[model samples]
Structure formats: C-alpha cells, structure tokens
Target: MSATQFFKISLKRSTIGLAPDYRAAARTLGLHRSHQTVYRPADSTTAGLILKLKELVKVENVASIPTSVEINAARKAARGYQVVEKQGAFTKI
Candidate 1:
C-alpha cells in the first residue's frame, strides 16, 4: 500500500477572542477546540487555512493515515497486569 502525505495540525489556542474571519478559517480547517487535532491533505487550500490561523495551531507532516482501530489503541491506557481469573465469578469482599 502507498502512503499519502498530509498535514497533522493541532489547535494550540482558543479562537474565542479572535476575529470572525480567523475563527471561520479555523472552523473550515476542522479545528474548533484548543488541543484538538485534524489531518488535512497537503494542498494549497489547507496551506492557506494554516497560514490564516498560524498563531493558533501547531503543524506537522504525517505520511500515512492510521486506521480508526489504531487511533483508538494509541489513546488507550496500558494495563499494568494481566487478568488471570477471567472465568471465575467475583468474590464477595
């Protein structure tokens, strides 16, 4: 399979007090909340939006799209121990 080049943008600031145009640009770019992230194809429209909201976001280049499962797995906390009593009923304390 081939990988597509895209921009991974994370909103670093809130747009509440910004100009309406600036906020619109951020909305168009799929960024509506601080710390929220979205991926866009590497193209002029995306570039223009990024430039328009440059001060409110952080950008990075990502080479491939990860599956939803992968994304979900990445966000899950790691378990420190294995469950060895799966077949047993819970014991009363």
Candidate 2:
C-alpha cells in the first residue's frame, strides 16, 4: 500500500480583527490559539483552507502523524543528569 501524507500547520499570527470568514477558516483548520500546531490530511479541501488562511499559518508536508505520547515527549524538556562516580565510589561530604 502507498503511504499517506499530511500537513503540519502552525498558527503564526493572531486572528483578532480579521474577517469572520477567515476566522471561521482557522477554526475549521482546528487552530484554537496562536502558536498552536495541528495536522490535517493532505488533500484539496485542506489545501483550500490553508490557502484561505495562508497569511496566518505556516504549513509543511509530513510523512505521518505523530502519536500524542510522541508529541508530548517532543515538547518535554530534556533531563540533565550525570554519573560523576560509580556505585563503588561512595563518599560523604
């Protein structure tokens, strides 16, 4: 089977003071707040919506959708840790 593709859209601008139709298009694109990212199937209908809100969002092609767990992991801060000494080298201050 052929692999499916999707579009990763990020809201780069605000919707305030914009036309109602444009705002509606943003909502239809599943964008709720500024800087939010969403994925949609790569199709003509989605393309049309992206075109309508081209000025407010950024779009890119992605091979597949990431799971919620993966997305959360990607957004999480990295843990900084180091083993200065091995277990045999226990010391008291």
Candidate 3:
C-alpha cells in the first residue's frame, strides 16, 4: 500500500481584524490561535482552504502525521548543560 501524506498547517498570523470569510476558513481548519498547528490529509478540500488563508498560515507536506509524544518533543526546548556528576550524600564527622 502507498503511504498517505499530511499537511502540516500552522497559523503564522492572527485573524483579528480580517474578513469574516478568512476567520471562518481558519476556524474550519481547526486553527484557533496564532502559532497553533493542525494536521490534515493532503486533499483538494484542504488545499482550497489553505489557498484562502495562504497569507496567514504556513503549510508543509509531511510524509505522515506525528504522534502526540513526537509533537511535544519537537516543541520542547533543549537543555544546554549536561550533568557530569551527582552530589554525594554528606555525613556528620
């Protein structure tokens, strides 16, 4: 079987002050806030919506949808420092 693809759509801009149609399109795409992302199958309906809100969103073609754990990991910040050693327990002399 062929592998299915998905569209990684992210709201790069806010919809405030925009036309009602544009707002509706974003809402329909499950985007409620800026920087929020949603995955949808790569299809014509999704393409039309993306075209309508192309200026407000960023779209990328992904091979597959990511799991919640993977998504969270991608959003997590990296720790810059490494732990070289642990503190030893102190004893009274």
- Candidate 2: lDDT of 25? 96
Query: Cα lDDT of model 1 overall?
Result: 0.89
Model 3 alpha-carbon drift over 4 Å, by segment: 1-4, 77-93
Write one digit per residue (lDDT tens) for candidate 3, span 1-93.
136588999999999999999999999999999999999988899999999999999999888888999988998999798888998999899
Tell me each candidate's TM-score: 0.77, 0.78, 0.77
After TM-score superposition, what is the CA distance of residue 36 in candidate 1 from its true location, in Å? 0.9
Tell me the tens digit of each residue's lDDT in model 1 across 1-93. 126479999999999988999999999998888899899898889989999888889999889777899999999999797887668787999
Point out the higher-scoring one by lDDT: 1 or 2.
2
> How do all the candidates rank in terms of lDDT, highest first?
3, 2, 1
Model 1 TM-score (2 dp): 0.77
What overall lDDT, based on C-alpha atoms, would model 2 receive against the true structure?
0.92
Task: List pairs with backbone clashes in candidate 1.
Answer: none
lDDT of 2 by residue, 1-93 (tens): 126589999999999999999999999999989999999999999999999999899998888999999999998988998888777765998
* Better model by TM-score: candidate 2 vs candidate 3: 2
21: Cα error in model 3, Å: 0.7
